[model samples]
Target: MTARSWPQTAPDSKDWVRDAIEASGDLVYDWDLTADRIEWVGLASGFFGTGDELVPDSGRMLASHIHPEDLPQRLKALTEHFNQHAPYDCEYRLRLQSGEECWVHDRGAVKLGEGGDPERLIGTLRMINARKQHEARLERLASFDDLTGHFNKLRLRDSIDLCLKESYEANVTSAFLVIGVDNLSKVNNAFGYQAGDQVLIAIGQHLDHILRSSDTVGRIGADRFGVLLPRCSDIQMNRAAERILQAVREMSIPVDPARVHVTVSIGGLVFPNPEHMTAEDIVTRAETALRQAKRDGRDRFTLYQASQQQNLLHRRSQTIVTEVERAIAENRLCFAFQPVVDAVTHQPVSYECLIRLKSASGELVPAAAFVPVVEQLGLVRQMDRHVLELAAAELAIHPTVELAVNLSGLTAADPTWFRALKLLLQDRPEMARRLIFEITETTALQDVEETARFIQQLKDLGCRLSLDDFGAGYTSFRHLQALNFDIVKIDGSFIRNLRDNPEHQLFVRNLLGMADAFGLKTVAECVETGEDAGFLANEGVHYLQGYYFGRPSLERPWLAGSQPVATLPALKSGAKKAGAA
Candidate 1:
């Protein structure tokens, strides 16, 4: 009876073992050292989980699981071991479960015949997928801020360095604007956490309202917004800071209206070119100025100053603020006309009405010099309203010459603006043909599909549309393709030295060619010199404007001696003067 009891094994015991592992839905394998055979089964095999099958001849089977990165050396060692009739050991990656990837650890040895021939190799495979995935998730969480979806403080340090390098390579300067909510603590204390959150989100919305889309704004600290402005100047940064402060002031953020109202203080540092100062220095200056704003009285803006900057830092800022108010009050904001020549005509097809401010000192400042502050304070729409009235009056005077005026994103969509426009156009039906309203590519893009409707409405009203500063911010050639714009103003940056810079000159040529294809007209702005003007004229710029053509001024009136439907001066007469002075 004992002799009759013998265990029955399959003819190919190896295949049977593999099939069993597969049936169990586990990765399986087998190795026969004496036969130099290595067999693996199933799509998801791991070393430690199925080590038993790989026993007796595990070396070759385990080697298949080794990561390709480590497989070379591991395989060589295993092969050497086999040649010497020693132990078998190896590890590598194996594809698994519908192409999912998994890292594994495999280890084992080979059993040999008494004649020194390898018979079988066996091992175990362990799955490391969960641990690896956990590590990756932690890395992502470490890099991102949970609230604003901005980069976290830890990531900011790393990102700023890269930003600096990129800015330098692009020959662009970087500026930092540090914003702190002045009334945040008050809100959190008087109201509640929810109110504070509402206020923060509102600030973010308004900040986005004022900044260029390319700029980066991050919530690196509680109740703080840190913005990085690339390819910017001190003038640009300070103006943006002012706008940020102004936006916070105007936002009617629904937060326990009875509780403390939220406001923000802004301070900015423009990194000096040539030196490309350390990041710490930039932060230090900006923080110092922010502290000064808090000390001076919250809800204001300031520019960072060095030791040589003096008390005049605060004084100079106050003076500028006072000057802006005065300009707005005295109707010192004026318009200058720049001719937009038809690329084919090479003659004045129309005149663009530009705004400028005259300092109390009699020096004239460009709109870029102050419009940023106006826009930030929620005053730009008012300013735009005033300008439109003035433009209409000018159109009446220059009935035949076309007059193009700009509108801000918020102003163009104001429901009442159309009515106001109609009133301004009441007497001059001829002005319709002579009137073209221009908006920045950015404003045009704010609500692309919606904006198109507004633009078409303007056209329906018989007003022409010119998309200004086509490549200034977010507007691209694609916008030209998608939306209807009669006129496209090439960014002044490319036209500033069209004669000397081959790349820029080529840019103008390419842009003109593209505009021709789109049936859109081209205009050259900031044409400062004869060479630049001549080059652009040759490059097919229909019209040119800059110091060479004329500088902006309120006294200049509208182009072609147009009648003033109304003027900034008239608007100022109605508004109260600033209380600051």
Candidate 2:
């Protein structure tokens, strides 16, 4: 059949083609490459928002309506199709007659004439504005923070890496700064989290306004931001940090009924030789400086200065973190049971489970040697979970022995930890009853409502709660009343020399009085001498724990022939006191 008669052979065939093109929302075009003239069909006038009078009849006229930035892309796609016989497919922005821009997907095939030279082109243009808008939203989410509309952590790190590469190649200097919000927790506690969020957003805006156009800012943490400055030197970084500090300090952010004043501590590093540094290294150094700034006092800036002592400490912390991680993965994390004895009887009542890492050399590393580093590195949650698992397993094996396990502040506030507790105690009322969980006063006060809820949850599961390190944080009587704990362990400092120090004696008496009023059991920690132990028992302390009782031992104290406590000279002294009475 001839091409001209083919349409006539099928009734209403032209109508069907036109309906399909209009239904698909695509405008079809036929272009005569030699003449550069174009013929449009299928909603050309409606698609371009123009009638026949302004309809583009040639490629050159159509190019005028294409967005300037997108015209090059369209030309490149067409050239590829014409020269290499490739299928033309390009997405670009098109300007409508109303001056509104919309995304369009342009695809076509080149129809070649004799001698294989391109003579005609047929293509379809579909408005993909909705799809492009969705894609743009997704891209924004990927590269920018939702809260601040600044670069996200991943993108910020990538930008830092790119800057480092460029700086190294050009043999120039660059800087990275970490700014931490001061006392944000206090703001959250005082005015609620919504107000805290407003403070963060306001701080981000302030940073954006203060930094130069070449600098990049990102929300790298909940209350921390990272700034990357390209082509920056030491003096430039110091000046930039001062500007950021001054800007944030002078601004008052509105949070509804209340206005909040905020300040930030900045730590920065100027890397003249970026070739040897990674993004992580740079960030760590800057954060280190930031910590020093915070230590010197908030609302200040500190530039990183390399010191042998600081580097050694950093290396040691890194080594300990690596070793702790390895120890956790290899099941080398274990507990040493330190006996908490009846203050009067010197008989083991329960043991506090202290965490210890069994090194490759088989030496037990004390928690003091590594716990601070672990907590600083944000690995305490995992460490706390491991300690819980060990404590639970031990409780299962020793039914009669009650054990107390310490919980970190981070773990105490974690919902997952509560969930884990529920799972471990499920259908095991006996195990729960024998388990005791200890949290310091500072930990409980970190988020009092949350900690109270956590304590109640533990109590509901039949586990006893202890307020560890009672006087260390100068906890108020109201906080003590709010947190429902089964026991209150006096801070070790107050108990160290109870017999020798009258001040410590008075403090202990008052603490015991408060514990008595609350109907809480009292345990005096660091009872290292018989005289101190005797004084505590006479004062009605419920338990005593320290080197004088027995150091933390790896051997299960409940097992046969295990001496959990030293031969208590305090017991003999107590008998003498009773005889004197």
Candidate 3:
């Protein structure tokens, strides 16, 4: 068709249309149906290159530029539009002149002839490269963790579901495994959180590299990772978990001038009966196995055994519940005091009241034996109040003797326990001043905001606070700012080799320095020899507690009208420290 045969237009209107399409950043095209000729009006030349010769057939010319993968879809859409005069709205990749690719949204409709046959096709193409790139990035973010480059929780769950479905169809077994970094918090406490992040990144890379290609690894928790293996058998699953654990055990991560090592506690669940099992059930079982591994001892892998559902651990948990309920009923719950003595004077500054369980035979049970059982039974809050009541009673009689009572994380998480504690100290104002509540670092980190409020309430009641196991969990400088405690008890794990391990010494020194700057007193726990005590004293520890000082006794040393240091026997000559021994 000649320019004159085209639809009527004012003089210079074609020029105006060309200018408008160029300014709008659109590529305009016209395909003549009958004549089989093509014409490009706007920046089409700018993208396809200006000097290119015009081809008679638009489809042939466009085919050369359209990406091969997008060619079929574009052709199908074009064919429908040509046959039935359908609207064309599609996105496809276009190869530019510089051999780079660009995404564009193509939109238009067919212009019909008088005979009702298709005569021409016109369309506008706008570059959507940026939008496509943005969408790709968002897809990646939704599927993977930014720091560790592992699958995110949502993606991991979906992948596990897919694998389960596939395994069910094939009548095959699949496995889910989880690994928890045992001392990540301690690493964060000793070094910085950045160092902790580095360690996690290293671990993720290691797992991704070492695991089989069929397995998917993901970051499941703050210091935990999950692995999904398809078509895996029981033996294969156990071997995979062990291999990962061994690999993690031997890893030496660098913090600075010194290197820090870490170990993993792994749990694995292999499908025993695939029928009626969901992804969540698999994950739960794997987590249970992981917890058992950590409880038994970290740096190992535990496979979830179906038989264990009726095993001793479960029976023991039930027995503990029964025994604890009986003790509370018979008033057999009691407290034993372990003194925290002044570093220099060796006089007991405060007595840590430990909860003891007295049997029907009048034998006292150790805290370690029953404390975990009580916590698991969800009776920790009750135990906390029991300790609070006994400690308050002791404080009431001995006004000068200060008592430090342990509070579990379960107790700290509950507001009712705090209320009970307040009620106990309501009438005895002097007793509140003499009471010190010790909360573990793990417990405080569990719910920082709630624990902070709890700490403030107790502090307002004239009671002091001590953060027990200071270096054990992930106690960062941020925690120090979040909650103010009067005392920081150096974890016995570090104090065990304080004199022999330079690394331990450095950590304790750093902790002491930080605590001192915050106006918090430091206590060295498990100081079992004169040498350890002397080292702690030189390092400016305010208090020391251990067998070297005094063991937890049912009888209070202060009640005997004698100072703890005077009554306690001195360290035996040439006797190794408790840690050394």
Per-candidate TM equals: 0.41, 0.55, 0.49
Q: Report the error of model 1 at residue 260, Å.
A: 40
Q: What lDDT score goes with residue 60 in model 2?
A: 90
For residues 170-268, could you state the per-residue lDDT of candidate 3 as single tens digits?
A: 888888998999989899878877898899999999998898898899886668899999999999988898899889888998876568889999998
Quick one: best lDDT, which candidate?
A: 2
lDDT of each residue in 171-282, candidate 1, tens digit only: 7777887898886757766777678877777777677767998887766456777788877887888788777777767777676655345688887777655543445445
Which regions of candidate 2 are displaced past 4 Å? 1-244, 252-264, 268-291, 294-298, 413-418, 445-460, 563-581
Candidate 2 local lDDT, 307-342, one digit each (tens): 889667767877898899999999998877788999
Better of 2 and 3 by lDDT: 2
Candidate 2 versus truth, CA RMSD in Å, comes to: 16.4
Query: Candidate 3 clashing pairs?
Result: none
How many collisions per candidate?
33, 0, 0
Could you report the Cα RMSD, in angstroms, for every candidate shown? 25.9, 16.4, 19.1
Candidates, ranked, TM-score:
2, 3, 1
